[model samples]
Target: MPRSMTLLVLLAGAFLIAGAAALWLERGNAMLLDLSSSVSSFMCL
Candidate 1:
């Protein structure tokens, strides 16, 4: 039982590290566009 608990903890820690790494790698790859121009166009219409 103790061994299984240790394994579970290690697995959880690995998942957390992997998730953080993915976010760090993707931080600059993700793009957000300016929506104000589109909103203004819609308002003009």
Candidate 2:
């Protein structure tokens, strides 16, 4: 494959891994709920 294509594939793989990690860490709904609540309050102000 071309150099650019190889780089793109590596980057895409890394992004997928990172996203999977983040979702795993936030497996429970509590954290997201808290975050959304904070954002909602901030938006109302």
lDDT per residue as tens, model 2, 1-45: 999999999999999999998887778577878999999999999
List candidate 1 stretches off by more than 4 Å: 28-45
Q: Which residue pairs collide, candidate 1? A: none
Q: 1-45, model 1: which lDDT tens digit per residue?
A: 699999999999999999998897677344322355676788999
Error of 1 at 20 (Å): 0.2
Instruction: Give the lowest summed-lDDT range of ten residues in model 1.
Output: 28-37
Mark the regions of model 2 whose C-alpha exceeds 4 Å error after superposition. Answer: 28-45
Residue 34's C-alpha lDDT in candidate 2? Answer: 90
- Candidate 1 local Cα displacement, residue 35, angstroms: 27
Q: What is the C-alpha lDDT of each candidate?
A: 0.78, 0.92
The Cα error of candidate 1 at residue 3, in Å, is 0.2
